[model samples]
Target chain A: MDYDPMVMDDAESLGPVVKISQADNVRVKFELSNADLSFANSLRRVMLAEIPTIAIDLVEIEENSSVLADEFIAHRLGLIPLNAEGAESLLYSRDCDCDNYCEHCSVKLVLHAKCTGGENMSISARDLVPAGDRMHQTLGMPVIRDEDGLGPLILKLRPGQEIKLECIAKKGIAKEHAKWAPSAAIGFEYDPHNKLHHIDYWYEQDPKTEWPPSEYVDWEEPPAEGEPFDYDAVPNRFYYNVETSGPLGPDGIVTEGIKVIQQKLAGLIHELTEGEGGDNYDGPRSPEYGGGGDGFGYSTSYGGNGGNQSAWGGAGGTTPFGQTPYGGGGNTWS
Target chain B: MNAPDRFELFLLQDGEKKIVETVVNGMSNCSDFTIKKEDHTIGNLLSERLKQAPNVMMAGYKVAHPNVPELFIRVQTDGTVTPREALVNALKQLVAAYGQLGREFQKELALRQYADQGENGDGSGAQGGTY
Candidate 1:
């Protein structure tokens, strides 16, 4: 909020004009007008990967005589979405000050299911009962389910089969594991007419018959059906259909995602103007190239930056660049 | 392969965490900035906004590799505004954009909730049609 740009805030004058066309319990439709695709994709990715949610991370099986394996049942438990209404207060297990995991970082949930008198019974997520001391918790008696109040069917059990386990639910982002993802569906559409040629339809006969334009074409002008297409059309509008996975509502997910973006940008702003009068901190001035604490690695020691290593830091040892190249787009929380 | 440190995104390490490493050309009034642990989200947003800033000649960005998180941005200004000023402008815009977005979303959510309460099962509003 600080780092005064000192100029007439023209970009702020334009503002990021986003409008919610419709909103409900599960989904919200919005239109971002006069903005770049980068911002659109950033919002989508942040909501998908940055916003934290509560999921079962550690499962201690006490008794398992059901048909499914322990790990299989554990994985299924991890996928169940608990109400993460106040997940922000929950500490990540790695960042907690406790020895391993304490009540401050994780919640203890017990799942005990037995087929007493049924031919074949289905153990559901409704059976996982919360048993912890989290006064700050907002999802105390929570299991996402349909309007019929029936939780997801986990596994089937025989007449005498029973399963009992203690699950530790922790806060996590989707980047580390997909089970923590808060959104059930996210529809991000730009350039629906394919005017930008971003999509390549592999049609043998006709591209039109095989690949019709996205239904979003009806929202805009449809490019006038046969108007001469301009190859240089940058998308100035984006449509989003965001649906939550019961942990957070549609608006909650979006607002949380927007907050994450703000935090990232603010952190960068703070670093950029940390020690100097930010007004004059014009360019990158890293005179302290290889200072203390190379805990990141020897790559922090730039003296070994030779001209030989691969550009992308292939399986080779090191590159001229200071950091090691990785394989996937990892979250900062990982 | 060893994964890059996850904390590299925030911890302003001296040797690492080159948030923005810019090389300014004195003669051409252009600069190239390399931001670490970032993807196209900020890259494209800043470049597009920088291109629209006053006294800015051109702005563009590219990722070094699909596997790497680094991003490269090249900006040429017309001497009126420095490259850093242009970047700051873009950053400020992004901040305001997100701020407005959050407020608008929350506002719309409240409005819908209130409306839904008044009418019973009024699912008349058509959403951005399911894909």
Candidate 2:
């Protein structure tokens, strides 16, 4: 069967449906489908392993739009402009040993600076911690700096505009190995002009081949053949068709679409079976009631009408015991 | 080659709804409306139908409840629908139009069995596949 790579890629690349615009602040509006919700819930659990504190920072808020940060990301590395005053040691504790916040696990960067003037400012852990030392154990030190002595960082805020940063330290291994790694990955790309839609189809490639292949490719699978088709199985093939409106809300995901499809498919099965002519035919059975007589009538008895006694027996003015049926013989004495 | 023993018609979505009127009114082709025949099983027939009409641009097929052994003809439109209304209409139409086909088909099968018995001169002929 010839499968369209585009369709395959789209189906496999399902994830949190996020919409981000450069014109807006560094905020992403995530619309999660049923499948995406599972991904989100799993990602949330994984993130909670290391970073336990999470909060959403809304910037340049619109009337009906709000931006949400990944809970795991926020919990591990505090969002910039927010600080953990004394929560720095939470990163070094083994009891709190998550992939993100152990001694060799995390890095905390506190950036306090007034932006000279610009529409946006971007900062990341790499800017504060040295690339090699990001996961290395180290005492406190400034990782990056700007001319204003605010350490290694970038600020585009207007004059007198200040932002505070509180970062919790942890290991980078989890962030590195997370299924949904936090990076500038092009989740999906569609160009109306080119009519080309490229989706990032993530899978564990064969460790036997190469880390990064020479030529560009859209798919990956694990090393062993045993794991070859594990992720790309049948039930996983269906994509949730989220409605744009309803009680689910514009950003809400609907799971009932798949159920609806399954039902239709079942109905088709019925049609096919019945349509196949005599395949399902079975011979008729004898009627429940015997061959038609006066359906309710009883069989006749032997004697003629005058000689025939009723089935109950003869009834006279007086009963067999000498008491009349209703009032014995209108007895005035009684 | 035989027409279906019984067939059902369902208006899965009423095209009269204002929201679906525009697309349904413009549909000039009923060629996609189709019927297929296969051995009766719980899900096989419907699965094949879905594969045949994966992306129904204008309308969708209607189906009776999963357990009901009846045909369903649904008129689909590229919009949302209530399954209840669709099912009621389908049942009504099936009774009115295709009910006789089911009875006649049953009779035909019976007659074929009787004829087989006469030819074989044995009771086992009733179990033959000639029908």
Q: Which numbered prediction scores highest in DockQ against the true structure?
A: 1
Alpha-carbon runs more than 4 Å astray in model 1? A1-12, A140-142, A200-206, A209-213, A276-334, B1-32, B74-76, B111-131
Residue lDDT tens for model 2, A1-334: 3324465236334422321111001111222221222223322322222211111121211121112233433443333222111122223233243643433424445434444555545444334432334432333333222345454233334444554544444322112223112211112212211112122435577432434441213212223443333343321111211222111111111111111122233233233233334222121111011111312121111111221111111231111111121112222111
Model 1, A1-334: lDDT tens per residue? Answer: 1233434354456656666767766677788876677778889988887777789989999999988899999998899888776565556676567998888778888988888986998878777788878745455345555776768888889999998899998877776678778899999988777777788889999997888678578667766666886876778789999988777767667766776666566445545544333332232221121112222111121222222221111232221222221102212212
Worst 10-residue stretch by lDDT in candidate 2 chain A? A245-254
Best candidate, TM-score-wise?
1
Candidate no. 2 TM-score: 0.18
* Fnat of candidates, each listed: 0.34, 0.00
A-chain TM-score, model 1: 0.76
Q: Please list all clashing residue pairs in model 1, or write none if there are none.
A: none
User: Model 1: per-residue lDDT, tens digit, B47-96?
Assistant: 87786666678889999786666789888877777776667667756766
